[model samples]
Target chain A: MSDKPKILILDDEEDLLATYKDLLTNLPSKPEIYTTTNGARAVAMLDAEQFSLLITDLHMPEIDGFQVLAIVRRRFPELKILAISSVLEEQYRARAYSLGVDMCWQKPGTENEIKMFFDCIESLLEERPSEGFRGIQNKSLVDLIQLECICRNSTTLKVISGGIEGKIYILDGEIIDAEFGNLTGDIAFKKLISLKKGSFEYLPAVTERERKIFSSTDGLLLDAAQTIDETTAEDKSEVPDASETGDRTALVKPVIAMSKIDGVDFILIGELKSPQPSDSWGVDDSKNLHKWISNTVQLWRSFGDKFLCGELKDIFLYGHHCKVVLKTKENKLLCAGFKATVNNETIPNLMKDVIALWV
Target chain B: MGLTKAKKDQSIKLIITKPGSFTVDANGNILSSTLPLSVPDKFIEIIIHNVLETFLTARASGLIFEEVIIQFIGLKIVAREMRGGALIHLTPLKP
Candidate 1:
């Protein structure tokens, strides 16, 4: 109704409300600041009039910030909300985040914190009218993820649909972890990606949660797509034959080709992100080799970092009895063993040719 | 300090030179090394230990393998388990 942006400040302490009101009123935009000592009164005021932003304190008597956030987010999805707490525990902030509070932080105390708090408010007010990120609506989470992954962004995507909310964390284009209620990692990621309709918001940070999902974004999305297809097929037939044969066969094709080379003892193919081997032949224990590769990859990754030699794309082992070669492709691996009789001078060129073709 | 081949090279040559190598005993101690002084023994220990542990683990799981050659970009490490000890060679080649 007014040209000046309106912001609602809800806190139990009248003094803090006055302080925040005083600080926000001096903003360059000179926004209209509506301050209320009571949470219910703040909600009522918000309902009565349009507010550009909602800054609510988590600790309160009856209508706590969590409850207020839940109600306000559902009723006023478009309103930019920031939840603050002096208690400063992760559980409170995490709960607020799940409730869809736009920006959650521990209550500002230091000068820098105060400045950042005001800066956040000013930006929120500035973006009040713009449609850039009030909410990323209509676009599926997959599209948003692809965009972020391609940019190699480190951020957390929060998706809300049908009142269900989930968070997917991406660090350097890789989907490291995800959260949806009690579910986590790959299960959570699959569940979230399957969400067809949702408003997604992303923050420029990765979660502190332990790395749960190890697959690359492409691998994860591929798996998710396959999983979704399998689920849909289950409804169509009484006995749903959801097998990875088609995909696994494609993965093993190159390995099989290498295995057929002269003097090649066996070739094992495995997804670099997964623990189990994708396919193998002639090797006595493909699973064990995969396990060794997984562990060895971890070690080599560290070595790569220390030496600055870059990521390990392949490994070659030579012994008196045999010559073994391991090559890494996108998200999978190829390990081939050759007889001692094979020409040592020709193996590298031949292996390189096979690797060049494997991709 | 490292032999890195240009990507324009179509083939990877097997004749990469080994710059340094070391031997570690059953106790995981370094028996000998030709690596430069700048190369930390700690690094060599860790690498040998890792290779040895993984080899034993894999062997326990019924996977019998005697030699391991690992290649990374232009860096390579080849190790062979021999009589309760391991001989590890570090090679820096552009292939």
Candidate 2:
């Protein structure tokens, strides 16, 4: 076997692919390099041969960079993935990170960009994991497992956190099953993934096991992300906000005056009605706040609740930029917009005072 | 006249619902769903619980409503109230 490390380059652009291959070939390491224009073909090559590193572009046609990253993440957890993209959008970069890519480089096609790219590649190659039970710090366990799947390493991941212990069974880079107490499959997997302060030890795969969950690796990641998001949404409702400090002493604040909660922004008071008619509430013209709320109520009513009362009690929505806490009085709908940091406990009381004063 | 419908893809991708506890007894807590497996039950429970709480809070406050659309970074959720429970749809806008 050749002593040189093997490298794979995947890009749709033939010229760039060849150029990258040439650059890596001349490095002092003198690595054995391969190039492919098709993402699918590159994946096939990955399965057929052992590659020390993978450098792929993000915008390929048939099988894009993200797809390739997801597949490699599942089947080849040991293989380090480097993503190159001409479109350096934050959303794309974040997605790549979540999928377990080691590094993302924006391909500017300049000499300096090429030089920095090569330097990055050299650094990553020098720092590749070679020993058993290597210490990886400051990464989410979920991300780490995704990395293991990408490396295609069959290993037992043991996680210890706060007097709790769990074991995850990954066979041939697929998370065959996991165990934490009586939980198994996805339940156990999610518990392990949600450990924020845990230490993990990875031992080489031992006993073979039957697959208990058939979802793809990306599916697993997606489920984990959703689970975390929902947990955060729930937690936000219980957690006290820093802003809850100074605002509690006052009791006689006017309805219009009560609109400004420390972390909350715009406040709209309108009658609960359909969108067009809700325009009469006219809280703001810059944005149809009343119309949106009315439409929202309309959507809520369509869920087959034939006996829905004429009033909706409260609706708290957390979206991009703003979070809203909405309440309904006898004839008025109160929509209070707040930042994510608004204290959950203060919402009901705050809305109550505003409704008592106004309605 | 009888109503007709167009043929569409039958694959059930995602399911969203209000939690089972608040629903009338025996309707079985699932206010809505389209997924095949009952797996990820906890995740489903958490989501539905929050949705149900929001609607119940609205009902208690006497706000008569139809639907709610919530937008997150990569997700758009629509929850509509129905006869016995609510229907929720989760759509991922990005990866």
Candidate 3:
């Protein structure tokens, strides 16, 4: 019988995986270690085997580490779990604690801290509690409100109750961006901060480029409208002519046209290159590539109204290059023809995939 | 003789201070001055129209003039040149 305790470590960073493997190998017992880059895969592995300890990074592709914690707590109440995150956002920390995580560790500057975390786990394993902790019950909207009142999380709580959406942005869990449907900006955000919510959903963080594009469109529209009003006032004395108004209208039309499309979004372009003598394009690689493309297309398809007009130029796979073209609805070209050699294909595809997701 | 010589000297000084502006005609030859140069209002209007047209076209094609200034001399006008042959200076209106 193997006397050493088993451990599972899940993180997206490949280098971190190697580092953890090295660390674990040097330990006295040389416990069995399992490493995976994704949370979903880790969950599947957990279901198949028994591990004394589970260490997971918070942010990951597909499912986040927090969600993994939730799933584990529901199915396997006895397992010890540690939450690791690069972001030290209070909301994330609070949520981790609320989910009954045993310990939370921050990454990058805390190598010694991780060693300490393992020591604590070792002690906890020695003394096992007889009765397992019960999982949290599914709450109704009223129950959620009562929970918020008892333990206020200082942030916005956006709730969708009975098919109607409302926001309550809480400061120390006080309500703040509350409105019925699709409200944004300072006023809406302020309103949300003041609500006593039903149940709420946190809005996803937007990229810097997305914010800039939206603000710029708003400014351009305001300027155009101001220009029209001024022109009308100046021409009040003169007899109104249709041709003059038409020219004035033309000046503002371009601003209006550009505003209709969100320029920050990018389209993914895929390219395939002929394999070299040393290159290997086996079945596994081809399958992975196809899966990546299909998943990306499906995501964009879900947001049909936001990005329906965008086009995906045919995949360009040939000699040493492939490229994607992203253009606006106005047919104004944003980025054109990005190519990567066969030897360095991953970067170009990743770039295309990210841009497509952003769009 | 003295009065006539003095008057000729003044006219020469005026011409020197306010160099005549030029533009390309239909045949592409540089026309020395705008037609009816003595009429200040008409001359100024025509010059402004031409300048605005050139400015708009250059701006659309992403070109910019480094300096654009109008200078005026007594009763005669001259415009300095910049990139893309943009005339910069203007002369005072001739009464």
Candidate 4:
């Protein structure tokens, strides 16, 4: 019957429940907090009370967190739910996002961190369209493509309107090449960016092809942005006739491009940390890993001390779920983790770019 | 009788060169494949072309071309230059 908003916190550990309950009570909003150790009891509380937010841990003994999330999502479609756990794998985290969890918080530290966490919960409750890809309404094509590259998304964007269709290929977050009519690469990319109106569909596809054109993703995006800007600045009345217009008048300076890195999970720049058991790879393959590491060092030594060996590179192992790419610059070692789905052609450029950064 | 039976077997699962041999064009398009149809032609063609291109470049750079081998977690791919194209052999090492 209190005027304060109620929050439900569920966890298997009583101490964790106590910690959360204590943290929530001291917030500036002074939220009314309730704790339940079991998921079924939490469901019962959900049925009985009208809570504003639900924060549940994923790994529980009785009626695991995913089930609770499904029940809550189906019944209370508007209620915001957060998935928190200690062992958060990449795939598990991806699954949670797909299931409509507002956010996934790994662990909480100091009081200030807890307070910041509550702030995020409050923001999500306010309901902003911030997560996932949305239909392109008011957004420009250039900005959208740039966003995909920045996120390292592997997607093929199809644009179709007024019987004009084109396909842009993006792998490992870089614009590899594009095809529209008989055009390819920059010519095709320019025409696609010149479109006035079109509905876009992004299909995430696995790609393995030799890149016909070479230009940095940022460079291509910048060219598109500049073209769009130039077109917008031109007066509609002064627009030249189609026959008189020259398409090749504007040329973008091309920079040598790096290789695509589609499925790399993590890029370890130094010595390997004591990998957690939850890792999809690591410590479990220590013997083979040690041999691979020793070979990498020996290969570096073979280059001779006076050779500088700044450009030294090697492929440690190319497994299904794990790939060990090693590059040495000066004394530092750069290791790249690649998923099996990655295009093998990108490995050399990936090594070169990482070495360039380190040097 | 043996020729007729061999022709029927090829229709069911083509084995032009061997069970896992396949060929791609200069542009990496699938020209012919003996592998199962479930494995997309484009996927196989591009992957084979990319892997072989590395060895071909080495040959072009004056390195003696013998053979290149790639061992993935569950599969092993061995490529060797033959005629004007590369002969790719795929073997599943694990389930």
Best by DockQ: 1
Candidate with best lDDT: 1
Candidate 1 backbone collisions, by pair:
A315-B70, A315-B71, A316-B69, A316-B70, A317-B68, A317-B69, B5-B94
**lDDT of candidate 4 over A33-127, digit per residue (tens):** 77777776576566545677899999999688888887776555445688998888888788777766778987667678677787887665555
- Regions of candidate 3 where Cα sits further than 4 Å from its true position: A108-111, A124-131, A134-359, B1-95
lDDT of 1 by residue, B1-95 (tens): 13333432323332324588888887888888887777766667678877787567656654555777676666777788877678888887664
Report the lDDT tens digits of candidate 2 across residue range A1-359: 34578888999998987777878998778888877777766775675456789999989998899999977766665677899898889999999988778899899577897788888888887775542222464467777888889988889988765446678888778888888877888898888776555446777776666678788888998999888777778777765453664443243224335433345455566676644323111122313556666655555443312211122345665444445666654456667765446655665576566556555
- Writing each residue's lDDT as its tens digit, candidate 1 over A13-54 gives 989988998899999999887676666556655654567899
Q: Rank the candidates by lDDT, best first.
A: 1, 2, 4, 3
Per-residue lDDT over B12-71 for candidate 4, one digit per residue giving the tens place of the 0 to 100 score? 321122338666544555566668766655446445655556444434432333344443
- Report the TM-score for the A-chain of model 1: 0.40
Model 1 residue A336 lDDT score: 75
Native-to-model Cα distance after best TM-score fit, residue B78 in candidate 2, in Å: 65
List CA RMSD, all candidates. 25.6, 26.2, 27.2, 25.6
Residue A95 CA displacement from its true place in model 3, Å:
0.5
